[model samples]
Target: MVVMKKMMIGFLLVLMALLSGCQMSEVYDTSVNLCIIVANRKNQPDFSDSETLNTSLKNVIDSYGKVQIIVPDGAPYIQGTYSIEEPAKRMSSRKAADWRDIQISSMYNILTTTRAQTPEVDLLSAISLAGRWLDDREGEKQLLIVDNGLSTVGLLDFTKNLIRVDANTIVEYLEEKEAIPSLSGIDVTWVGLGDTADSQQSLTPVNRKNLECIWNSICIAGGADSVTFRGDAPSTGNNSESLPEVTPIDIIAEEPMEVPAKQSRTWWLGEEKCQFLPDSAEFVDIDATKSLLQPIVEAVANEDLILGFCGTTARAPGATEQGCQELSLQRALAVEKLMLEMGMDMRRIGVTLGRGYNHPYYINDRNEDGTLNEQIASANRSVIIFSLDSEVAEKLLKE
Candidate 1:
């Protein structure tokens, strides 16, 4: 009878141990709101970080979470949503691994079906859709964006000369259209900011910074809790032309130039002739500078023509945008002072500003070996005369 009593106590302890284990597992169970956006287009490379990405996948697989996938801004947007549920009963490690396999497979299948959903990628619209989806979720929210932040469509279209526009201006426009997302309380991470694939022009350092700043502004304006730019940038990008065509942004530096003449509507008075002292806006030969401006003055000499002088300088080491703008302003001012002395009205001279390296009328002055071509760069350092009557002039002047 004593032996039988001891056996009952042992059985009770075993059952208690099992119950304790179950409680611990339940305590650790967590759910996450994970939304991933993949921009599968011609201009963006694939998100090719295997190790880190697999780890992210594993975390979602091991927990009770909501997964959302989006391919944005085509003729129509594409999205897939799935929920991860915990098993009702505890299973062995092998079974758990098998469960993760099933989950990943299902997710992969959904991604496979999304490839043909959109013709091009529109990141803003995707973010808007993701924000709404996350609003429905009931857990810690996270969004992972996998693409070059350069959007080819919608209000933030780079093709529409949006690259030259400032971030604050972009935010204002987005707000006006109500296109910006409401991402309140959500953490946003972008994997690729300026990483571009072919049929797309590569971003310069300034262009990349501007690209990043614009997107960051948009996300912050949309009320995101945190905006993080993180990346495992892939060395190799997809160069397939079969993907939807993304229009290349026309960099002013790469545009063709026409010679300035007495009757010419546009004037590109280059540095070789204007002869400004090196690193100084002071004219090397005052008469030479006057001669260069004479043609522009002759062309826009009439009452109806308002001339806008934009000064450009060659790219230098460690040049800031503000500094470049200041230099451009100084150079244009030097010419403006001369014009004012020559009896041109200040009101008729619409813009006398420095463009620095931002507005290069001449093509890339950098050699294949990454050295500056002095001759090419000299051509780039010049003044562009814009007659306010022309469409291009009207556009820049916002008249």
Candidate 2:
């Protein structure tokens, strides 16, 4: 009787262990909630890419507890969700197969409907809305973004000056505008970025790098746990095959220029004959100034170059000496601010000075009455970028 009791106890223990193992396995099979946001802004959508993404998505959703497709162009962000059944008795093989088929069919329908119904894509709004939808949702969350990642409309327009802005500056702007979304605990995957035909114009190598950097920073700033990019490589097209492979401009200082100790070399901005507006430091032609500054910016970034801004102004009618000096200082400070905003390091910029009506470039071109020459007075009312390193002349020549 004692042996029989021991045998029974051992049998019960084994059975309990088996049941516990089964429960652990079931827990491991828990489902996830997947959110997909598609950008449908291209003139011609790539159906092949769409199909590839859909297949991958279906594979992911097969094990998901729930799935939501967020199509931004629609009035309501959620386009559809996979049908989920209530927890009950274990399903038979036949029933499980039927459920999988139904879910896949539903996913296909959702994709088709989204592609057909979406008219224009507003990327920022879509992300904001999707983030709101996912907030406080249950289950493991995943966000899959399908778009070129370009914001064509609203405050974050890439077509405007936004692209030229630095990544940190862009993030600050978005935050100030209350445009960033809360994406904490979400894993984001960006697809189809820089892949569409329409993106050819805007998706150069540098631009693509900038876009990825900006998006990555934005996602991190918005509290995303992880961000991944799975997009087509940026292509310059077959026409690029016929084009010549241009060499990179060498901006290094080949031979340092000779200069006296404590003296500087000056690089002027405007025509020798033109003058800046009186009491104003703003760039008269921003585009032209940008073009000229590009090389200087690059040289400074690539080499050991230190830059200083000296603002000088011609004596304006009734403008006191102090006022002129103050205006000149403001102009020099303005140039420094512009360069800093354009992504230059602040450490490289030094010594902003204002010299009012002093050391004119064309002193001999004065009017017959010994007053400043109007034709060449504009030259004096300018910002002079100088470098203490005499080597800058050689570096500028290489550029």
Candidate 3:
């Protein structure tokens, strides 16, 4: 009897040890707040890939602790719980399966309803909204953006080649518009970029690469932890394949334009009075402006020179400081896009800084009678292009 009792005690001790080891090997579930932004529009072909998108959505919803679906330009948008509740006990297989089914049904309904309601694709607004939604949330945060990465409205207008503009330029624009969101600790995944089949223009390899770089830069600048680009069909599993690597851009040197060997030169591209329409960034004469920029473009193409554009705006009556700054940045970007079209290297161009009512060409715009002078204010609304030699360019770049 004593031997039998000893054996039973030994057996119980071994069983407890094995159970503790099994418990240690088990991974604790860490909650994640996931936000998914879907861009629904006719112009974006990626939206048509419903099967892949739905599968990816289902997989993510099933895996994450909490999920939110947001469509900035559509109805029934921004639906999902902000916080996830932890249960006292682990969910059973049946309960988990039911929960997933309910979530999938809810996601499908919300997405379909939103798509039917709105066809506009406002990617910037949707992303900003997602960032705002994720702010202050606990646990791991992830943002999945399913779109062609095109913004037709708001500060970023892809139709205008805004993506070609430098990242710093876009950051400044966002700051001025108060559209910058706190996205620290967020892992951002951008899927379905440049899949614009129904659009008037088709995307080339170079165009696609530029678009990806722009978004990557934008997300990083906005304090995102990381940015990944997954093409039209992202894999739903852990070993999912990544998008094809973007090739380096080849810069072809063009014939140099005749200009004096100067350290720096500033060219003002504007009308006779340097006048622009009230709160407008559209150039009056694109052809003439390009003609004037030909020399600078040639210089940048042929030499290792850097181009810097400064946009200055005059404060109009009742114009907010932020509004003026945003207008100036847009005007600068307009010129930057022209330069890009003219075959200048995107990396060679510096950030377009917006100086709103700060650096005025016509400082004496105030009339003797203390009335605001429209002519001088108009002069202030000019895009000044500065061409710098190698030394000057390096110095300014360091600064």
Name the best candidate (by TM-score): 1
Off by over 4 Å in 1: 1-30, 48-52, 235-241, 251-399
lDDT of 2 by residue, 1-399 (tens): 999999999999987765543311123255566778852334323433454465545555454556677765523266676645532554554565566567667666666446424334456777777777677577566787776665555666665645546899989988999888788888888876655453234345666677788888888999998998885443233222222222121112225456645545566764442233545776666666666677777777876667877777776556777887888888778777877877789998767777766553424446777676776766567677878565543333231
lDDT of each: 0.72, 0.63, 0.64
lDDT of 1 by residue, 247-323 (tens): 66765443446755433256667776777787788999998777767765655556466678888877655667678
Candidate number with the higher TM-score (1 or 2): 1
**Candidate 2: lDDT over CA atoms?**
0.63
Order of candidate numbers by lDDT, starting with the best: 1, 3, 2
- lDDT of model number 1: 0.72
**Top lDDT hit:** 1
Task: Quote the lDDT for 134 in model 1.
Answer: 89
Model 2 regions more than 4 Å off: 1-30, 39-41, 47-64, 74-76, 86-98, 116-120, 198-202, 232-399
Q: Candidate 2: lDDT of 32? A: 62
lDDT score, residue 144, model 3?
Answer: 84
| Candidate 2 TM-score, true structure as reference | 0.48
lDDT of 3 by residue, 121-162 (tens): 456777877888788677668888777676665567665657
